[model samples]
Target: MLDCKPASTPIEANHRIKADMGDPVDKGQYQRLVGRLIYLSHTRPDIAYAVSIVSRYMHDPRSTHLNAAYRILRYLKGCPGKGILFSNSRHLSIECYTDADWAGCLDDRRSTSGYGIFVGGNLVSWRSKKQSVVARSTAEAELRSMVSGICELVWLRLLLTELQLYKGG
Candidate 1:
């Protein structure tokens, strides 16, 4: 891993990612780097938003787009030791939180949905994906994201229930 500078936040508060319609560059290198970042996102939820944003421009990345991706790498260097930590605890309740940005994508006008799922106070799963269909309103987008979250919660609950049964609960 390259030594990188630390960013106060994974992404800029007002930063927005779009299709990089600028002049094309080496597509292979850009795709490789983006793929690495996506894998890193498995352990670093903080970079999820920024990575997802830059991924939209994989087909035609410009200098500006590459710079943004490099910034994330620098941010990662600062928090090299940061990762999900699990602890031994009796509490195994499943809970989740969901949020959405109504019409956040400027190009397609699709909403961005984010959700985090936790078990026994430890984050087990999370996501930041663009909604498939454009939402007519903010409430609609939020509701849809919540529905996705609920699905995750249900699956988690069932999995845990099976685990308990195996342990003779």
Candidate 2:
């Protein structure tokens, strides 16, 4: 897919990817592609959410899942220079933002939670994963995401303090 057309976005907005959307695809191929995407997501947090979605169907991938994976590749091709850039900053305030889609999964009605941790206004951590427990309400889903973000923030704060880089608020 070296010469393939680039996609403007990694995924379609509000796209519901179900298990039975399309014909079955090769499991090995799908797993390999998703594995590579997962590795890439470590440094390309922009694609983390999309990659996580595609990785869900690795066990029994369908045409729809394959297409979603292709979209990520196309997105990467379009933005070859996209990657995290960390520079020295004087400020060290920690900020975290999190959100969740309540019952976003059509198959199992599970919500996906995501969070981003920023230190000194630079993104230092991020994650997008399906919640283990099904949330009862939108507020619950949001709280679940916030809890995950808080855990990460606590760990970060501890690490910064240990290194003598954190200033007590």
Candidate 3:
């Protein structure tokens, strides 16, 4: 990463990635690169969206698609220390926030949904995935995103509850 060049943005805002109908590349290498990026998403939330976008094209990636993935790696190289930091604080509250872009995917016309869950000012979980169904309206897309966020909340609640019970709460 240190030897890679930095990208101006993690992903191109105006660019839309789709299943590459173009020439195919080495399947093994493509999958390996995407897998690496997915692993990196565990700590680098900033690259999650970009990596998710490019990963969909892994079945038949072209030079353009590979370049996009490489750009993300370059960005990662420049910001190696970029990650969430948990502080030693007594505050133990859990909260979730969500947002969505209706018809965000240009190719399939599906919406993009994102969510972030935090506990005591530390981001515990986050995600960005395209909705399975195409939403007719922005409100509907947003509602779908809220549902995803709620799922995260439930899991986090259960986790925190277990921790509390272990501590004899």
Candidate 4:
């Protein structure tokens, strides 16, 4: 997709991946592309959700998946230097933001829970994953996401305590 038109965004917010849509394509190439995207997502959180969506089709990809992969490539080419930026900021604080979509998955009707954690104003941890349990209501989905974030917060708190790095009460 070197000559393809560039996309401003990696993935469209309204686009959803469907397992049973489109014609089947080569699995090997699709998996390889997804693998590279996954690796890229490490520092480019902007593409994390998009990469996660495309990665789900590695087992059996189709034309639509291939097109999405190409779109990501175009996005990457548009801004090769696009990634997280961290500096030596003295301001330190443990913060996390979380959100969930009620039955967002087109295939399973599963909700997607996403979170981002920052330590000292630097992004340290983030996730865009589908929930294991099927939530019956929007409130339930939101609570499930909150629970996940709380678990991560508790773990980080314990870790900070063990390291004697934080003294917050």
Per-residue lDDT tens digits for candidate 3, residues 25-124, read 7778878999999998999889988888888787778777787888898887777788989896677677799999899777799998999998878898
Best by TM-score: 2
lDDT of 1 by residue, 86-134 (tens): 9866777677999999999888999989999988788999999999999
Best-performing candidate as measured by lDDT: 2
lDDT of 4 by residue, 14-51 (tens): 88779978999989989988999999899888888888
* lDDT to native, each model: 0.84, 0.95, 0.83, 0.87
Sort order, lDDT high to low = 2, 4, 1, 3
> For model 1, what is the error of residue 95's alpha carbon versus the real structure, in angstroms, after optimal superposition?
1.1
Q: List the residue pairs that clash in candidate 2.
A: none
Write down the worst ten-residue block by lDDT for model 2: 82-91
Q: What ranking emerges by TM-score with the best candidate at the front? A: 2, 4, 1, 3
Residue 139, model 4: Cα distance from true site in angstroms: 1.6
lDDT of 1: 0.84
In model 2, what is the error at residue 50, expressed in angstroms? 0.6
lDDT of 2 by residue, 1-169 (tens): 9999999889989989998899999999999999999999999999999998999998899999999999999999999998999878889999999999999988899999999999988999999999999999999999999999999999999999999999777
Clashing pairs for model 4 are none
Worst 10 residues of 3 by lDDT: 160-169
Number of colliding residue pairs in model 3 = 0
Question: What residue runs in model 1 are displaced by over 4 Å at the alpha carbon?
Answer: 1-4, 165-169
- TM-score, prediction 2: 0.97
